[model samples]
Target: MPISLDKVQSTAPGLVDLAKTAKVSLEKRNLFGTRAKVAVVMDYSGSMTREYREGRVQRLTERILALATQLDDDGAIDFFVFDSTAAHLGEVPLDNYAGAVDRLTQGRRMGTTDYAGAFRVVRDHFGFAPPKLAGGEKKGLFGRKKKVEGAVDVALPDNLRPASEPVFAIFLTDGAPNSKPQAVQALIEVSTAPIFWKFLSIGRESFDFLQQLDDLEQRVIDNADYKPIGSIDALSDEQLIDALLDEYGEYVTEAKRLGMLA
Candidate 1:
């Protein structure tokens, strides 16, 4: 059966409350005080089959897209799916997000989960590169051009370069990562950049490894945080947003103190 876009938009349960809570959360934390970019990175491995089929992921995506519409001027979100590798699903418009989420979940499932791959894709998408990292320009795994020039720009004074918009990446997963060291390394490299990673664990799985992300050593800043949501249906929209952003308020406060985020 075909789903009408209007019906999908009008019938989404808790959407209004989700949007309201999202706005309140952002305002309370003073996050993205200016225009910011939003991205949703979903784990599409076999372990996530049940959540996808149950429509939890789709509903969550819709709510986040609603948040994006309120926080971002463009009102669109960049979407990506990861298994052994990550694939960009393009920007989903707020008005047509239901169709986009449906299409994102309608694909072959990959066997393993690779968090590093998804982070790499996002870093390249936003043209972020670490200072003093030298390598010949090559195409990104997703076919986007990886320019070494972007690294040099990172060294320039804030006044010299164009103003940057902070990026909030919402990563949803259901299990442990296949490569922990690589994932930790990627997070460390982007810590100084204007990007914040909010990782949400779906279902009742033990996310012990993910919970330790904040304890990692030798980072410019604590750039990521994790929370487990046993069931999306169990929480009110406000509660859901609060759970997802539990650590984000402190992150933003510390980021400002360190002069990392404006």
Candidate 2:
């Protein structure tokens, strides 16, 4: 069961409405009793400076925390940020999530976007090995050969690896990554793991690549979904919750069918 409403009311009163609404949505989608680890990957590239400064990132974190309260027993979200590289900032609990966005990002210089680097961080954090390419080298965008980290002679897909629980990761980005092929390969590598990635586009960049990932093949199961939020400030609480969870039910069903979720 999700954290009680009285608990949310006392712990994070600001999130009471969001958590209540999310509960309804979860029940509507038959997800009321489901359990999963919640995580958020924020974009810290140069383009996201305005978002951080304007409190939009903080707002987004709050909203995600609201949902996390309903999905995670610990009432916290695993946090990560990526620019040219990535790092885990640990868990942001409901009691201490108000200023997490600015507090966690302070002093970090924004650089180019590197999705693969962040993807690798998340994959390794969950104890999954990187997927090995068939020919020893994987060609990325423009057919250029790329070297991936943590690759080895493993013939089994990483998806077949044992995972203790399902992870629901929200990957928010403003624009495309610096390397498209690397990002694509990284997603394919973890396609079989017990992780469902929901890519939320927070700008007007069209997010063509993320959309393409929805149809990415060669995986044991479809483990991703993408939605374009355009502007986070303009979306209502109900709308934001819907965008975050609309496709989650299907992913859960598929994961259970494949024995990734119990």
Candidate 3:
């Protein structure tokens, strides 16, 4: 079971309502009582400066933390901020998540976007092995030309490590990655594990590259979902939660069917 309602009210009174709404959202998706490790990965690139300053990042963090209170056994979400590099900001607990965005990004300088670097950090943090990249040049995440800087390697069959639970990762990015091939390869590798990636575009970008995750044939499972948020402020809590969790229940069911989770 998740954290009790009594604890939520006492520890983080502001999130009490949001947590209640999340419970209802989970019930609607038939994911009530589901237990998973929660992660929120934020893009700390130069383009995201406006959003961060406008408090949209903080708003989203609070919302995700509220949802995490219901899904994660520890009532916290592992947090990461990334750009050309990735930084593990540690866990944002239900009790101390109010100013997480500002607190974590206070002294950090925004860098160029590097989705693959951030993905690799998450993969390693969760104990997944690095995936081999096939030698080839492919369209980059921003539609730019880029080389996949590695030798061709044969894809292996699914030999994922056994785990008792799944990981729900919410990745927020405003634009395309510096290297699309690396990002794709990262997803392919983590697909074998029990981690589901939910990529949310926090800007007006189409995120065409992310949409391909549904049909990417290199993975053992469909482990990702993408949604474009034109404006974060426009969404009510319910609407935000719905978009964030879209297709997640199905992903969990499929993971169990494939023996990724017991």
In candidate 1, the residue pairs with backbone N, CA or C atoms under 3 Å apart (3 or more residues apart, or in different chains) clash, namely none
lDDT of 1 at 229: 75
Q: What TM-score does candidate 2 reach?
A: 0.87
Error of 2 at 258 (Å): 1.5
**Model 3, runs deviating above 4 Å:** 131-160
Give me the overall lDDT of model 3: 0.77
lDDT for 212 in candidate 1 is 59
For model 2, how does the per-residue alpha-carbon lDDT over 47-129 read when each residue is reduced to its tens digit? 88899889998898888888877887788898999898988878788988888877777788899888887777887787765
Task: Give lDDT tens digits, candidate 3, residues 1-262.
Answer: 7887789999999998989999999999888898888899999999989998989888888888888888875878898988888878787878788777788778889998887777768878888665445343333222223223431232323564557778888998888888877777766666666788888886656678877654565565677878888786878999989998898988888778767788
Q: Using Cα atoms with residue i matched to residue i, what is each candidate's TM-score against the true structure? A: 0.77, 0.87, 0.87
RMSD to truth, every model? 8.8, 5.1, 5.0
By lDDT: ranked, best first: 2, 3, 1
lDDT of 1 by residue, 139-161 (tens): 22112232222122112124323
Q: How close is candidate 1 to the true structure, as a TM-score?
A: 0.77
Give the candidate number with the greatest lDDT. 2
